[model samples]
Target: MRTQTLLTAMLIGMATPAALAGPAADFRAADANGNRQLEFDEFRVFVDLRANGGNAQAKKVRLFKAYRLALGKVDYDGDGIVTGDELIRFDRANGKS
Candidate 1:
């Protein structure tokens, strides 16, 4: 049973990075200006576009807070920008990889 549990944990850890690859690709594509970083407006648009058709206006305040929190996590350097490398580091820190 212990061996099986260890194997399962290993598998999950390995798959985490692969699962995040799609989001990384989406981030790259969402970088319209190709500045290699996501600014507030760009990140906002990306979040809205990926919002699954939800009525953003209905939850404007809540959504804004959530967006800010997400961006804060990725903007590790606190420079008001999110780069791909920062995103990867964020994911790792958040246990997504």
Candidate 2:
């Protein structure tokens, strides 16, 4: 548990805030179900939170696009869920984070 915490902190700390474009905290916040993994709905909520919208409707639109793109990029096993490990691997593989 200690090691996992340390590793999470290390990974979070290693990425500069700017590089992540607000996603580090966003990812944590997105885990809304508290399951330590992101369901599609939770991920949609997260992407919605991170998206910029001129108004509520615009935000929803942006969120939908972002969610679709993010789902494609992160859901590696097509299991319809995303784990932190999967997220990390996706980011690393894509030259992100």
Best by TM-score: 1
Q: What C-alpha lDDT, on a 0 to 100 scale, does residue 82 get in candidate 1?
A: 76
Task: Indicate the worst ten consecutive residues by lDDT in candidate 2.
Answer: 9-18
Candidate 1 per-residue lDDT over residues 11-72, each given as its tens digit:
22221112455444555666889887889776665555444334342134234445565566
Off by over 4 Å in 1: 1-21, 53-65
Q: Clashing residue pairs, candidate 1?
A: none
lDDT (0-100) at residue 44 of candidate 2? 69
TM-score of each candidate structure, all chains considered together: 0.58, 0.56
Report the Cα lDDT for residue 93, model 1: 62
For all candidates in order, the CA lDDT equals: 0.53, 0.56
- Candidate 1's displacement at residue 46, Å, is 2.5
Clashing pairs in 2: none
